[model samples]
Target: MRVVIVEDNAVLAEGLNLLLASSGFEVAARTADAPSFLAAVAEHRPDVTVVDVRLPPTFSDEGVQAALAARAAVPGLPVLVFSQYVEQVYARDLLADGLGGVGYLLKDRVARVEEFLDAVRRVAAGGTAIDPEVVAQLLVRRTSPLARLTPREREVLELMAQGLDNGDIAARLVVTERAVHKHIGNIFLKLDLAPTDSGHRRVRAVLTYLDA
Candidate 1:
């Protein structure tokens, strides 16, 4: 598949280009800024675009805004979004047009070459590959009951969706496992999940969130 990459970090961008090249895909164009990024799309009209959520000038959500622009410029163009952090708000925006021909994955997933390539292919073929972390993040405040969670709770929720255990989360957050457990309980209760001890709750929650 022909693809374009829009990432501000030169090292990471070059690395991804080589990876995509090695994976038997054509790198039609590469740009680190928004203008050139959009130019490449209009010039090449690639089958899929591998876009970073941040870009030059602001290093914020420029890439995301660019993808939205591309959608307007060329309807049905597939977009695969990669980000250093998982932001559900951005994911929702990208998938706002109904979740087809779009993917939102964590940049770390690029290390798993096969999965990364598969995500590209999936989005190009008109499918969604929202990271489980993103799914959980969106679910944090979606419950019927209102729970005002702190930023730390949101971080814990993001980690939890990655299938991390309480101790593992504690180590990552540099907190006690009890804190993680309390966060999980609050999340489940706020989300109005059925009372269940089975681990399938997360899975079920993810599936429901994605389908929504």
Candidate 2:
């Protein structure tokens, strides 16, 4: 697969490039800043992107913002964020739209080549692979509305929060699509959410769950 590496560290970038190349993946580009990253993506449209959570210039969340922008530019583009730290707030924003073709793994994970490569392959294959630590952080919110839900309902809600469609949720729960929709409706009611046509039900549900 063709890949782009967005890391500010020169040595690390070179190492990753060499490693991926040896692993039979094409390295499209290695960039530092947000603009250069976007440009490389536009040009190469790599099958996957390995991005650092912090990048050059400010080294804050520029890489995260760039990843978000890349998603907008190329819907369904696979992205794997490599970071040393796990920030629940950042995790919320990263998975805000829904969890498809995305991965957030600690940089230390790279030492485990088998698992790290598996994560990259999974993301490229249109799968969700969130780090356990990140998942724990996301589960901490436990929105008050979620308390009203039964165990089954919460199971469905968690899948929904992960951006799974009714069909996906049903398959996961071994139920019918109708049942999944029913669970969603119940979630909305329990959360006291007024249905709106705004195109952000997932975002609303997550925000409400976190607030609660």
Candidate 3:
């Protein structure tokens, strides 16, 4: 897959470039600021983009804004936001479209090659790959709708938001796949998400958890 990287830190950017290259992904472009990142997006039309949450000039939220804009210009553009901290507001904005192919992960995750690559690949394949910490922070809100979920149900939802499948959730929770399905069914029912909904139930459920 072709990938574009937007990071101000030269060392980190180069490292990521090398890592993706070694993993057989083409590093189409490496940009430092929001403007350049946008330009790269238009030029390379990469299959996915790895962007930092902060960028040059302001070093505040330019990266996030650029990512949002790029997706606006190219709908469903896969974006993996790599940040040093968990900015819940930014994460919410990225997932606001309710479309998959989105990810928000802390930069620390880069140290774990396998996990990081999995997240990238997942997002590239039009899936959500939210960081566990991001999911936890969002879950703290627990507003109406979500408030009806039992504690175990909430746990299952959290893992689901982290982009884990039924098997993965089962392994993580040390439960049977059957048990995971039961909990997911309960979650959908409690959230008033019918099986016939147009969207994927798992994604819709996770969206509910995030939107809560």
Per-model TM-score, in order, reads 0.65, 0.63, 0.64
Would you list the C-alpha lDDT of every candidate in the order shown? 0.76, 0.77, 0.84
| lDDT (Cα, tens digit) per residue for candidate 3, span 1-212 | 99999999999999999999999899999999999899999998889999897677745567888999999888889999998854445557887786659998988755689889999999999998887876775565344668767999999999999989999999999999999999999887666454565267788889888987
Q: Sort by TM-score, best first.
A: 1, 3, 2
Count residue pairs with overlapping backbones in model 3.
0
TM-score of 1: 0.65
Which regions of candidate 3 fall more than 4 Å away from where they truly are?
A: 109-111, 139-212
**After superposition, candidate 2 runs with Cα above 4 Å error:** 109-111, 140-212
Clashing pairs in 3: none
RMSD of each: 11.2, 14.6, 14.3
Candidate 2, residues 1-212, lDDT tens digits: the string is 99998998899889888888888889989897789999999999999999887676655567888888898898888889887745444556777666458889988755687787888888888887778876664575444446667799878877877878889999999999998888877766555453552366667776765665
Highest TM-score, which number? 1
The TM-score of predicted model 2 comes to 0.63
- Candidate 3 to truth, TM: 0.64
Candidate 3 Cα RMSD (Å): 14.3
lDDT of 1 at 80: 87
**Model 1, 1-212: lDDT tens per residue?**
89999988889999889999998899999899889989999999999998987676655467888988888898888998888754434556777786349988887655678899899999989987778866665666455222345667667776766878789999999999898888777665444453443466566544444454
